[model samples]
Target: MAKDYSLMEDSNRSSNRSIHDISDPSRRIVLRGGLGMAIGRLLAPVAAGSAGCASGARGDGPLLGFSSVPVSTADKVVVPEGYIAQVIAAWGEPVGLYGETPAFKFDGSNSAAEQEAQMGMHHDGMHFYAQDGSRSGLLVMNHEYADDGLLHADGMKTWTAEKVRKSQAAHGVSVIEVEQQGDDGWQVVRPSPWARRITACTPMSFGGPAAGHALLRTAADPAGRRPLGTLSNCGSGITPWGTYLTCEENFSSYFNGPEKPSPHERRWGLRKGGAGCRWHEFDERFDATRHPNEPNRFGWIVEIDPFDPGSTPVKRTALGRATHEGATVAVTRDGRAVVYMGEDARFEYIYKFVSREKIKPRGLRENAQLLDHGTLYVARFDADGRGRWIALGHGQGPLTAENGFADQGEVLVKTRQASDLLGATKMDRPEWIAVGPDGWVYCTLTNNSNRGTQGEGVDAANPRRNNTTGHILRWKEEGDVDGTRFRWTHFVLAGDPANERVEAQGNIKGDAFGCPDGLWADGRGVLWVQTDMSPSAMGKGDLTRLGNNAMLAADPHTGEIRRFLVGPVGCEVTGATGTPDGRTLFVNIQHPGERPSGRSDPEQPGRYSNWPDARAGGRPRSATVVIRKADGGPIGT
Candidate 1:
């Protein structure tokens, strides 16, 4: 018989699992052009709902540990009464003495050089280093993107040269030393020696299939060996050898291009005619002429050695570049590392990279280089629990010149195109994916809001969209991550049971959730479900804007999805990892309030997301939340 996981699940994971922690108070502030509209845009909806939740508790429902509630008001975590959480690091902690973060100069005036020393905003995905904090390993996190005009001193100005340059630098990753402060909490070690920032200017090398290809060569990199910038660093992965791998998401939108591009550019959806991001106006490097092969260089999984500050990060091209949302890896039973990845755009495809050489956990050197050479494959799943991994091999199979696909090299260079050639099912905006130690791989089909309408399809994988309340897909690798086939199923459809949309997806039969974005299975195999992109209240079909975003733990065996903790208004829950002991769970909350949607108050002056800051009222900060069991035991029901 299968192991009865429910017996091993944390008891009452639901008690402290739910709490009412919503609070609303308008703070007078300055506005950046885009952020000034937040009040008017949200006041009628969000603030109104928050007001209702504050008017006193309606029935919290059963203590099945399933209710999702707002953050605690007592300056501590508010879970179902059985769980607890604490603040680990906030924005602007003394991370590597960037001189006290220079007050998040939101204006686009800061130079690229200065921005590198400061922590990037909107920290999304992060990983806790198994190595001791003192031993060089640090928590490496993706800053995603500097939201609105935050991260600048006088507020973003002119979106000009210096400002754009500053924006670029503020978009990578921050590595900081953190250690357990107690049985269940973690804190950053000030002035950490291992703390470092990987910005757009950081020196990096290329790896994998397209490392030195002609497509990757730019005027600045004639040899096609080095790429200077990294942008839109989204979710990430950590190899068994202990290096951090961050992927670039939405890179296609960064550059502006022609309606229909050349074959190569079209493979990745770039316009053949021009540059994107308007960075060309201020910096020639952004121009294709100056860097003809530049665009092809991004969209690959870039690896950073957190253990070596001086090491040059490597972009593993073999993984195939696209709008890489995130990378998650599982060590197959045979010791090879299988990296699970996604392309985070509507109708994008999911991918996996399996190394030819088996992984040795202690072989840091080999493991570090393992991602350099590999065969990348995209995924196609069926609702009935079975699927196939059609190989988009380089010169292999039907991917040949005769059939319109020229070669393996071309396949690597034009990944999406190759996946299309092989009939890889177009998926909902696939995001972060995680593999459980028990050998089950779980993925989040973030949302396919525009799939069908945009000439995309209702594929077996991405079944629905505006799919306001997304679902979680899970599969078990057949023998290994490299297997050509597997079993799959929609594990959970997110929504609120009390709401009508919940009934629409049939999740009301179990649990109602919205936008299942982040998926992480603990060492003991408890899956954590996080919500994002919940639609506007009401019109949301069966889904409603119940709360900002939240984190929940699910017992795969029992079908029980209990709410963990909800975030403040206008934020997304992302980037999760646990201390080795599993008692402390670290979570990232990003872009609270999106800075009021437009305008700037001249007096206060910071446009957008005053959260995690004092001026925005409350903490007004974007910080990582740490949760633990009250008894200091492993959590996740």
Candidate 2:
């Protein structure tokens, strides 16, 4: 089927580690009449237009910018002077009833039942809300995804019905309340009420185009209004109303799609690849012929009320389902919620959804419905760095075509088909999204096949070929979310190391690294740039050698990218979150140096990334790393 994946890439999926390789592991804009004050918050002499950064300067800690470093190697975390990193949480760390992460080993034979209680693997896309700005609260994060036996006792293969249950439990999200003791500290809050898991086994509600649609029904969810689990909960955002919004990235892989679907079944772009059916080895739910509606239940944005853990999670159908990467929330000129999303895939598309209602504020009832009603749009960014949101509403744009969409519900259920119907600009694999507090939305156009001089032309928005190296784009919405228009600009272009030569002009001597992903904006507007270490990029001497994927703080106003932290070998700096006080920075080091497993005998390798435990001799557990200033000062510097 024809497709448009631009909205949010359900990228870096599939037996991850293989895809999560930071070295090549994969994976925005502002509007406003304001005079760039977000970028103006700093004294950036080199990077001038930088209005979006956390002001990385402090009294006398690590110097600001990417000028200094500790070492070189794709297996270590690098940071400016004065900063130290500590692993906060890692895979197998217990969080539920059984305690102590359930008995575990890095084998695929693990029963899904055991998968619960333990922390999920390959932690990515995360956010931090300071429960007690001074010390502790909760750290909400996404496991993004899991690898084969990589995260299980056996792996994806040895998954028994019991194992599937645990895997389901392990696939969603983890929340932990924590407290800082002193200079170098942090400990779990031993199970606070807000602490709960929203795994693939948890109950979730549907509220969009596909909701209650007969096509979405399954033996488990015969009513079609609910889904048993949510796999691929990737990058995410916190709503203005204080709820946690989790994205469903690469959710398509969890179901089974036949080589060809019958007339009544859904046919995604996967048919071109053929030979599917991995989940079939285990359950009938994976059988498309028997469960045509299964896959549709996924690929939509999910929202969970963190404060009230018992609330049923809602999937905003208005957003239009596809391989949703992550979403950022913005307030329209009229005050409605505008969510920007990207579908991470080569030649895919970008999208936006403006809620029918406005997000009034924290603790407001209307804010909850803000995402229930709205219009969805696909993006088309031109070479001049300008773009527009193509309306996909009923009777507008592609939805007007005479297909099967007789109403708004149909338009939404077949959102992806509609986007394809409209000629949306296919972009580089897009990932992790962040909207600045100042009204600008930014997305990481990870990379694409430029077709160099061949096929895929290098457009202005995506200016590179096979764009191994990526760039960040920021756009300002027209008037507001429902305006039907928007302006765009390339906020930053990721490049190789300083001494590297550009495919064109000057020796792009700067720290413009490759494949941008995992983005989040702080209270002060500092843009944190994290790089996915590509094998070639890591081995490229100094040009783009990030040791591993490094997290850099950039001044969007001045366009200066500074390396803040580096991950270990075979790992990516997938998720980074911080306290409002800006004292502690929590980062997830996922699947570092996974011992290069051989596909032949999948379970032979006995090594794993045992992070945080700091106890693991070398085995690195996909874990969360905590960074703080040596002297107990604010962390941004």
lDDT of each: 0.60, 0.60
lDDT, candidate 2, 332-386, per-residue tens: 4555566778876655667888777655644535566668777788877654445
Q: Against the correct fold, how does model 1 do in TM-score?
A: 0.80
Candidate that scores best on TM-score? 2
How far is 298's C-alpha from truth in model 1 (Å)?
Answer: 0.5
- State how far residue 357 of model 2 sits from its true place (Å): 1.7
How large is the C-alpha RMSD of every model relative to the true structure? 13.6, 7.1
Q: What is the lDDT of residue 152 in candidate 2?
A: 46
Q: Which parts of model 2 have CA positions greater than 4 angstroms off?
A: 1-67, 96-111, 153-159, 261-267, 271-277, 362-366, 450-454, 458-463, 478-482, 497-509, 534-544, 595-619
lDDT of 1 by residue, 1-637 (tens): 0001111111111111000011000111111111000111112221111111101111233223334455321222356566776775665554665344444433334455666666676778888775662222367899876643344444444456776676677678888887765554567776766878887768899877677777778877888889987878878877655677898875654555455556555555565323224566677665544455677777778988887777888988878877887787665545666677887665567888878877654546746667766678877764344677776686677688886655555677678767766656666667877664334566787554443444443343333424545566666667555788876555556555565432235352344567778777655445677766532332245544354567777666556666777776556778887665555678888765443333223334433335555353222346788777676555552
